[model samples]
Target: MATSESANSVSQVPENCRAPNNPILKLAFKILCIIAVSRESLDHWKDTKNKDWKEHVSIMVNRFQNTNVTAGLVLATTTLFLSSPPPVEHLMAYNSTISYIIAMISFDAALLSVISGSAVLVIYETSTAHKDMETLKHMPRYQVIALLLWLAWPSICLSVATCFLFVAIFIACFGSDNIVVNIITILACVAFLSNGALTLYVFAVVGKKPANGKKNTPTQVIDMHHASIGAACLPR
Candidate 1:
């Protein structure tokens, strides 16, 4: 009776715990196990890649924090300039109103861009904080759009703000009664133009380098997995 009960209990064990009897079933189970193991390995690889991507994004966040601080200063300066305009009678008549209007519009646009970019970046960072694997793999349409706006919009708007600010300053200063200030402003403008020209020349010269004089085919799409290799090749 004991032997029979023990045998019956063994036969009643769960199908998953028991080895398969048929050769085909055994082969199928082996394949499933292999697939499961491969999937786990692939997930491990993806996790490593995700960590690297996060590090890159963290660096970006730090740089953007500095940019945002600079933009904040610009906003403050713009606000002060807008609020403390010269008295109506004292205002210069050389298209001063038009320049002020341009500066005001540019400043407002820049503020809006900065706010929107920050909000989008926050949302993107929050949503991907836990799981960026899917984001990296699928690259959803909305994510792409958000990423583009976050990366480009604020900087472009800030550039416009600075340009308009300088333009307004130049117009106002040129109309001023102080000869020394006018001469200094003129020299500053010349320096600015020369620096911009030199920057462009340097960029043009530096962009022509190839690997050991063998022209590398420009890759259309950059793979995050290969980003480390490319970074390693960069000058320290």
Candidate 2:
């Protein structure tokens, strides 16, 4: 009798744990289960990779973290400088239209750099907080953030060039023909051209993959049991 009662209790456990009959809730539960299982599988694979290639993995992770922090600081400084309001005399030197346009472009570029820098910092912090296995699960998202951050630098450069263009126009229009002003205008033009060229170079080179000498891919572990359980729990 006791054995039968224990068996009945065990049978009811699955029923108790089952999702509601509502289709939406069932679907949501299934999705959540799949995601959880997927994360587990990824974590297991990460662990395996760390075990098999600890030194290489550590070097790569450290490189990424250092790069992120360095890039974030540079971008944050640039953003702060660009976002600050110019002096009254500087603003008065340019026409209203040119001033407004430069201001808007600078603001937009600054905002983008801030966001990019913030994302990189966040990814670096999060990666550092997690253990090796846990960090691997987030690498894809971090890569995407890094790509956006790289693009933001070029955008900032372009904006800087635009600001310099307006400065050149301002110097050309109302300024005296003094040698000092002429030299400044020439420098501004050179800066604009340099920035434009650098922007083009960045866009061209950003897509190339680093020449990491390793040919062996990391071994991945798939949790078939967890996947099967998740599939079984899903609604027909």
Per-residue lDDT for 119-152 in model 2, tens only?
Answer: 5446544644464544433455445334334533
Give the whole-model CA lDDT for all candidates, comma-separated: 0.58, 0.47
| CA deviation > 4 Å runs, candidate 1 | 1-51, 86-95, 140-146, 207-236
- Return the TM-score for each candidate structure: 0.58, 0.34
Candidate 2 local Cα displacement, residue 173, angstroms: 8.2
Expressed as tens digits, the lDDT of each residue in 1-236 for candidate 1 is: 85798666555543333335688855544433222221111122233354665675565566556556666777787776787756532333234686678669667866965785576567646765765444343454345334444555556667677777777767776776767767977997898789989976985686575556655455622464478778889998
Which pairs of residues collide in model 1? Answer: none
Candidate 2 segments whose C-alpha is farther than 4 A from its true place: 1-92, 131-179, 191-236
lDDT of 2 at 103: 45
Backbone clashes in model 2, listed as residue pairs? none
Best by TM-score: 1
Model 1: weakest 10-residue lDDT segment is 36-45
Q: For model 1, what is the alpha-carbon lDDT of residue 48? A: 32
